[model samples]
Target chain A: MLSTQENAIIIEDLKKSFKNLEVLKGVDLTVRRGNILALLGPNGAGKTTIIRILSTLLHPDNGNVFVNGFDIKTQPQEVRRSIGLTGQFADVDEYLTGLENLLMMGKLYHLSRSVITRRTEELLKKFDLTEAARRPVKTYSGGMRRKLDLAASLIAYPPIVFLDEPTSSLDPRSRLNVWETIKKLLNDGVTVLLTTQHLEEADFLADTIAVINDGRIIAEDTPGRLKSRVGKERLELVIKRQDDFERAVTVITGNDLSHNSAEKTVSLAIENGVNEIQGVLNQLAESGIEVDTLTLRKPTLDDVFMHFTGLKPDEGRNEAA
Target chain B: MNSQLVYKKAYWMAGDVWVLIVRSIKHIYKNYDQLLGLTIQPIMFMLLFRYVFGGAIVVDTGTYVNFLMAGILVQGLAFGSLTTSFSIATDLQRGIIDRLKTLPIASWAVMMGHVTGDLVRNGLQAFILISMGILVGFQPTASALEWIVIAVLIVLFTLAISWIAAIMGLLAKTIESVSWLGFLVIFPLSFASSAFVPTETMPAPLRVFAENQPFTHVIEAIRALTLNRPVGNHLWMALVWCFGIILVSIPIAGYLFRRHGGR
Candidate 1:
């Protein structure tokens, strides 16, 4: 919050393609120093591609990227020295013990042996992997593997860290554990760029949320501001009979209405939840369409996606490469 | 100032390579099954050739095991280099290579680590085969200086093959393909060369290839050095071949490693 003017990462018109499939169609982004930026996107939305390019693991075909004031193209070594990357898949050495993995990573950074040793111990204890420090990573569970992977990335105490879907496949409990760990990273004044498909994750952790779809950032703002922009509540109604579905659609006045004809359900954005619900019920009564169930909910990232793109999160562009 | 910076860069690169080498060596120690395989395979080859084929294969040397010793040592070392390809391919597949690439360390350290670790492994395997040869009827009549030269030649040959293996690993799409790729390249070189038998008895075409190829010269050089026979031009030819392989392989491997995580 104090360092909002200083940028840890700056990406400009980044474009990349795998063969003919353009993964990033001119992505421009920035991460403020000492802030958590959640790259919110569905699968194959170029979230991972952006992370890869930023980490210097992959090249961008076009545009400029700078990390910690070092150009990604001309000053890659400097950029690498300043950033740590924890990929979507746990990239730690399976044959190495958790402690050995951290030590190896620390040595790769050319840290002194004493610093490496102390950092290794500190990280192992911090991640709650002290008991399993001596065990090979192959023996670890998925959650433990992720924690170790994150720990390995932080061994060098890099200025910036990139986590690509850190909690994608974790169980509920394990997901919470990782969230807590990420919060600790933020508290320690580390800049974080984490990509996640989970709306709640982005809402809970991000200082700034950038919703990416179809290889472009559709929206970027503070979570509260983005929520306010997507201020309309959602009304969902499951109709009693399939025959009433057609009549129900005609009864809905909102142009942003989306319906599943097979399920006999209609969902639409409403400006006023209470008044709109009463109006909808009366209209449905007049139209002789009986609703089986109805629910009103606050707008989430899914609703934000629908409001912005007029497409559901899963309906975003998926390219095969 | 520029020269000093370059020297400093080189110094750090060496340290980086050494660190990665230690990591790679630790992998070999931890993977007991791989170590067991490395041990049992060459010993089995030594025993099989010394006992089963020793009677029929008549060599112009002192004993069958002595002639076979050089072949066995060179062949074992060549085969041991196959693990370099497998390890590199495994690292690539498992994203460890990406992790290494993302670090600020010199890019060449990754390959150097694997290659140097393999050199140590080949050295250890060579020591094992030589001890086993002595335990059997084999005799090496070289002096200490000759032994040193032989060790140098062996290490050079291991480095050459290991670099080529590194190239194969970088080119391979998967760990499974790395095995096939390594076998396709190394199998023919070890078999068609003067590894197990003299090139004179081989068919005219294979004899031509066996005589001209790198591995034959390496085996011949080691054989001459160990037997205290005239090395002739074999040592020069072997050195040229190994250096040639290394010069060609390093750049190709480096390029492939850069393009690796692009996928």
Candidate 2:
């Protein structure tokens, strides 16, 4: 529905199949430069397949991928040059000291010995990892390895970087630390293409969010816009009397009641405004349905994802997004 | 920071594989105890076969250690080179390769790094084996220039065998499976060539097969240098054998490496 020429990453009609399984079926993605494009998807939704193609690790059976205005198939090395990828599990060599991992990446990027050395120190300071720089990576905590992984990717500071669930396994505080680093990168004008299943992550970091389900994008919008699609906030109530509940449903359903179930004891969905609650109580009081409970809140992104995908992701894929 | 910097940085990464080489070395250094077997196992084989079995078999009327050690050195390289291939397989199984696969430098650099690293490793094993043989009274008969010829011959043979091992590593479905599969190559080559004794001591038909084998010529070429004997037609034959393995194994390994990962 939209097109951008100067985009950092553009994927069109991308289809990839393995043997009999069609992992990605006609997917399209366009990531604006310098913005964090959050690719949110449930497990097995072909998120990694998409990332691999964009990063030039895999090729699509059909369609074209353009990274920094270069075709991935024809100019893969150039595409690779324009992007850095940090995978689901940070595959830093565990035997190497954390400092050595970053330095090694800097060297692999072909910075001069002096340049790689400089970048190594800079990244260590930036990631707040200098304190543990000499420790073997295996000794570092999950969060530290992730931080080191991020620091290593920035050795060359490619314009676009792909982070595959860089924070999925992190504890809240460490996750927050990673978020701060990502924010710093954004401030530095680095474009991040992040694939994550955490709705909160997308909410906290995304400039745009695309919800993928069953190998296709089901929805794409700003986080707030996606949440708003779940409809107006409401007070849900379960009462004692069935007749009174029926009456309450009739009364509340008369207004802005979004698809509720009255079959259960006294359930009434009403817009979550005080006026609406007061209006429902007056109607319920007249019908003699003694109210048991009532609560009101705005819908969460979980609700939005649940609504669109028809089911919430019951099992999170432990691997990075 | 800018497009100019990105390509420039990636261009530079390819030239700095030494850091990765160092990392590989450090990994080995850390696990020094575990690799003691890699360094010493071949030495034990040399001592045992050179002493116990040495006098039993004769190839060209020389110290059997000198003759058989040539073949043993060839066999040792063939054995040691598989470690490189298996290490690649292990890296893949451990998801290490997956991380490197996404890096910005030349994608093929990972394979190159592994191959170079393996050559270093194979070179070490060859040196240790050669040094031990030198200590056991094995002397070089060839002059310095001829010695260089034999060293070049050994390097080529090792490279070819390493490529085949690399192919096996890439195609095997599981790391454990590949590790076990690689051992199969070692046995036949070691037993069928002049590595343990000499091709002459074998039963007639077995001797014919042994003499016809590429490894037989490789060992013969090494034997000629060690004893300062005339390098029979086997010298040319050894070079041809090494080139043949390289021609066949490289494309096969390259195809499989790309098939498994170059996607």
The prediction achieving the highest lDDT against the true structure is: 1
Which tens-of-lDDT digit does each residue in A44-123 have in candidate 2? 77888888888777878998778888888898777766777785733778778998888777766656788888888888
Kindly report which residue pairs in candidate 1 clash with one another: none
**Measured by TM-score, how close is model 2 to the native structure?**
0.79
Query: What is the per-residue lDDT of model 1 for residues A1-321, given as tens digits with 9 covering 90 to 100?
Result: 222249998888999988888889999898989999999988888988888888887778999888888888888888888888886643998888999899989988889899999999999999999999999999999889999999999999999999988887889999899899889898789999999887789988999999999899999999878776676577889999988888888778773678889888898777776887798889999988889999887777678888789898878777632
What would the per-residue lDDT of candidate 2 be over residues B1-263, giving only the tens digit for each residue? 99998886665664656556676667666656636767787788888888887767665646777776787788777777776677678777755676666665554456666666667777777778888989997877778888788778878887887788888888888988886788887778777877776566689999998888888888888887778788889899999989999899878876777677546
Error of 1 at A152 (Å): 2.1
Worst 10 residues of 2 chain B by lDDT: B102-111
Per-model TM values vs. the true structure: 0.89, 0.79
lDDT for model 2 = 0.75
Backbone clash numbers for all candidates listed: 0, 4
What TM-score does the A-chain of candidate 2 achieve?
0.83
RMSD of each: 3.3, 5.8
